[model samples]
Target: MLVNKNRSSAGFALPTVIVASVVAMMLLLVAASASTAIREGLYAQHYRRLAREAAESGVVLASKCLELNNDLAQWSNSAKLRPNTDCKGAVVAGRTQYIQQDGNVRTTFEVGEPERREGSIQRITAVGRTELIRTTDGAVWKSYEYRLAGQAGLSTLLDSVSFGYATGGGFAMSGAFFTVIDEFGRPRSAGFNGFGQLGVGSTTDTLTLKQFNIPANKRAVRTYTNFLSHGRNMFALTENGEVWGAGLNNHGQIGNPGQSVAWVTNPVQFALPSTDNVATFVAPLGIVTFVVTSQGNVYAAGLNEKGVAGINSTAATIKTPTRVPFPEKIRADAHSWALDSQTAYAIGESGAVYGWGNNEFGQLAQGDINERRAPVRLGDFGKPGKTKAVQLAFDGDTVYIRDSAGAVYSAGKTNYGQAGVPTFRLRAGVSNRCLAAVGASLRTENCSSTAANQKWHLDRTNNALQVESNPGASQNRCVEATGHNGEETRMRWCAWWSGGKRFDFRYPTNSWSYVYLSNSTDIGGRGLCIIEANSATGDTKMDSCEYYTHKVYAPYNPTLEQVASSGVVDITTDQYFATMVYANGEVKTFGLNNGALGNGVYVDTSNFDTYKRQAYNPTPVKFILPPGVKAVSSWTTSNGVDSKNGNTFVVTSDGRVFGAGSNVTGQLGIGHIGGGTNGIYPTPQQMLVLGAQGNLASYVRSGYGTTVVYANNRKVFTVGNNSNGQLGDDTTTTNPTPRANKNTNPQRHVKFY
Candidate 1:
């Protein structure tokens, strides 16, 4: 066909326009592809950065593990045990993970077991991973290495913990990592910031376990929490024995002269005296802090609190630390609890046990309840006499005294029978007349030991009164109400009247434990006080006993008396009873029994006669130990608040351990709990039975109701409560039986390492 030239030109222009459009579309496609690749690279870098941070956290924790003598399983935040996590030759020591909402984005780290080498260097491996999507193509993984080595000549490692019941959550000791981990195994150090007790550098609460900045040369050794601290005040003692305080300072308790805000978020080294190094510290809560210098001088600061500080001033609170006028220099010391009340005991360099301060319950055993302004000799200790006190423990309103002859005596609040077997006569706070049995009838008579019928002992099993024909007589009678409010108390054989003679004691003050007769119909809120019937030698009658200075043994310090008395801030203050392993290989418990005493009196303690039976008298714990086994040290378990009732474990000279007392939490390490009235072994049971050789590990630690020991070739062996994975056995199961560590090699292991 023939084509015209004019028609060919029009078709040629349309083809050129199509080619131009195609070139623009290709450029746009190329630009879009380049932008997508850039975004992918950014995402990969972001994940990698997160992985790096996780790896860093793991290495820090691993370094701590090395510092703690290579014991990796004693942490509450230990990663849940997983087999073969990111290492072929190395075993996993710790693992943790962080995740963003619904686990869409996550970062994780796993620490390998530390390997010790020459030059004191430790090799640590950490595996870090991140994921935006659940696929290898969208994930990042990396391994980071860390070398943890001690100073060339360093030879000491301190792994310790200090705990006390306080209004706030609590403070952590220096050697232990007090990290509260989240459900994802991520550690959190944040808590209530009202008083800055966490020492995280700000009053603002943060979840990350922030570092407590201190001098590189200084390390924390002990933690102290004020028993009456409303704002959660706390302080730490350094390895050099200098005080470093944090949190609330409202009474200048932290030695910060002008804390305008009344607290600190960061720890500040205390303004200690420049002259001497510290020998020890006594912090029984409240506002006072006592420091005993190595030269044996006593210094104190903060609230006098019954003159316990011994500064001879009655000021509201001592703003500066001052030396006390105590007579003699002391080697060891202990004190009582409470803010408005206190008592302190010290063992003089001459072996005399001296006491001062509040004596509301005759806890100082000076034959009276008068508060001492300064130190006074209570008795001699470690002397060569049966009556002399050899060892002493002061807590609450009681003092536990152990004699050289092996007899134990408790002097303190006998209210509710906590002071053990001693019986007393109830003297009317108003009339001064004592409750006495006048020829089978109850009457208010003059208080006297000669009034044999007046001696009344509490039936701890049922809170009933037991009056005897004479003191220590076999015949017993109980006091009860004959009729209504205006009638006399009826005297009947304890079993003659089935009405169940029950009486309750209530606290009216720091020293008065008031009584309430349970059967009285005209019951006042507290109890029917036997007020004067005629203002003369009053005929015993029931009347209202409330808020009056009308009784003996009043209790006002709201915490457990036993816990207050037995506490020490430097070491484990959670112990309830005073346990001693005699030189003769016998283990004895003295102080408030509360079923933890293991003295063949299976204390069910579940209430009843007014209160549970308790004993402060020293009692023996029977154990069927091997012939060569002789007692050595003792470890007792208690939180002092929630776990006030406790268990006892005794280490023998032959590397074996004997356990006794309450087993409700299986804290006795007996494999199986005793099926008794209170799930306790009234007698001691051999739990940690090892070789007959003296290979027993010396380090043993107990928390709440758990016990940990390094016995099987030094590999960590955990027994007792594991409800929170605190045993570090990689399991949450609370099996009473002891658990072996994951990479448990041949070694003996016990914590408090």
Candidate 2:
């Protein structure tokens, strides 16, 4: 603590001088650290760029390698990596291969192998590493590692170009026939010309597109047609807001005064009065046409038998376009109508989806199959009018939705796993409680949405009840009976393929709806039904199917798939495809995958591609998310059952999206379509659509062999099957990849009421 003020300057220094020297030393050390940090920062940038280059190189090599191997088919080891030319390496630690380059800019690349390698496309990653060096002597210091993901293999993407812009806002297709208005306002068409449906002044089919006989110089803005085999009417909206039609005139489908003629034979302007000239969209399908005017009014023509036209008319057909009683503007398109099934979905201006026509399978999500004479708004899974839908598509009895959140929901005909969730909940008629899982045992408990224990999904695949998910007892477990009378029912392991507890869910008339175990007997063979115990005990037991003391309350449809005491058993032919893409990138897929679920599980043909329907909850699709990156959004789609195949798509944290599954029609939009594993992409192939002012699509909507993409809500693109000109490229040939359809599509005036 003592300081000397005077000391020999050469031998000893003053306290202040010594302290100042120490401080200077400390400052020098800090400066050295800062310099080191700045150097590392620069090096980090260089390494990242190097890593990205490495990834690019890997992709380039793989592209050549896959080509050499004929897309893995020609590879001697098709299931694993086989070095080809400059692509040298092996399947090291699950990854396909490792590529090393010699230099100070050290680089290594690895191809990421999925659980299965069925597709021609594959994913690869690269690493760039560097060593720290001492600035004084240039001696090696420490090593640092960096991983940077860069995309490549876009040669095909660059080849795809836009079909060219046309003022014609939209197009429509049906039964190998397409109705489109070219940029020159000519109504061109090709494909099936039955009943003069081609409107080319003749009834001969033409692979080459031909123009309609509309002589008027009206710039067409919208075109409408149908996929229905029954009525192939085509309608077009003019820039002047006038409507015109050519094709089937039966049922007044062409706005004719009467159904005296079977076909229009030419493009004739409709005499229907429309002071509502702000018509922006025209939807013609089945046997009806709906014109959406900017004034928030919908006008309808043609068949009115099911009130699909929404005119509420007793007259089976309307000769002229009549004002429909729709409360808002009709938000419709080519896929909006499926009138052949007496079912049609109409999007209201309020962003609400309305359904009419056949409700036979509750495809309307109305909770009942009662025929809807007029359009009825559909309810969300839990409540009514909560979700705002953007678009909708149908595959048989099942319906697919493109809602506001970029997610898909399903409904109707769930017996084959079409319904994404438990169609209904069962309550005990003997008590106020509901049937629930009490520690893997069946019991009566207070019903609440806070837990999934009370929610039961009927497994039509095996005729058992299963608990869907967590926050409750027996999660992912199924109900089973010992085939003994008065035995307590318990929740146990479920076999997705088979061996699920075979309990027959029965709905008996003039009696209670019960779960019957036919194997149960009392010293003699006699069926037993699951019944409720005392309200205080919250226990469930098996009793005679004729037990009069208990009842089962199904809040929704009771005509579910089950073994009736003596009636019909319903198993929907529709494929149940439900997937949830949570904000955190977690996905839950329920029901069936058309061909393969991409979870290393495919169709078990012996079981007819069927898993124990509803016996299992939503299963997770496999992929390891990289650290610091998670899934932000995803798109999964399927058309048929597990036998037909489907697709799964996901967007990653790196702003990239990938597709896996059937590319039979090039639905994956990766530029090619084929057979077997070549078309069935069991692993994900990155989607980087380019060309025609291309950019990565922000949203994707895949249809039967066709995919439509919207980029930042400004541009529209399509790929896959161009059969019938569905790709809107003015060509009927298959489009191997995505191309721009960026026409003058009007900004949707979606009213979010």
Candidate 1 segments exceeding 4 Å error:
1-156, 159-198, 202-211, 217-241, 260-262, 276-286, 332-341, 380-390, 403-407, 425-539, 542-580, 588-594, 599-606, 610-630, 635-645, 656-753
- lDDT digits (tens) for residues 1-753 of candidate 2: 997775565465479798999999999999999999999889787766665555555445555554444333222223332322233343445542324434433455444432211112343343434444566776656554554443322111111111211111122433345444543555666655665665788767666657767765666655666432343666666767777777777777777674468677777766555466666666666467777777767777777765656676677787787877765666644433333345667666566667776654556766555667677776552135454555565544556555555555555554334344454445566664667776667787765534456656666566666766534443667776654443557777776433326664443433312323322223234455667767788877766666354645433221322111111111112234444445555544454544434454444322431233322223334433334545555555543433333676655545455666677777677767755464676556665563224364565555455665655424456777766565655567787677764221211111100
The most accurate candidate by lDDT is 2
User: Model 1, 317: alpha-carbon shift in Å?
Assistant: 1.7
lDDT tens digits by residue: candidate 1, 384-419: 552444456543555655544555455555444444
Model 1, position 576, has a per-residue lDDT of 38
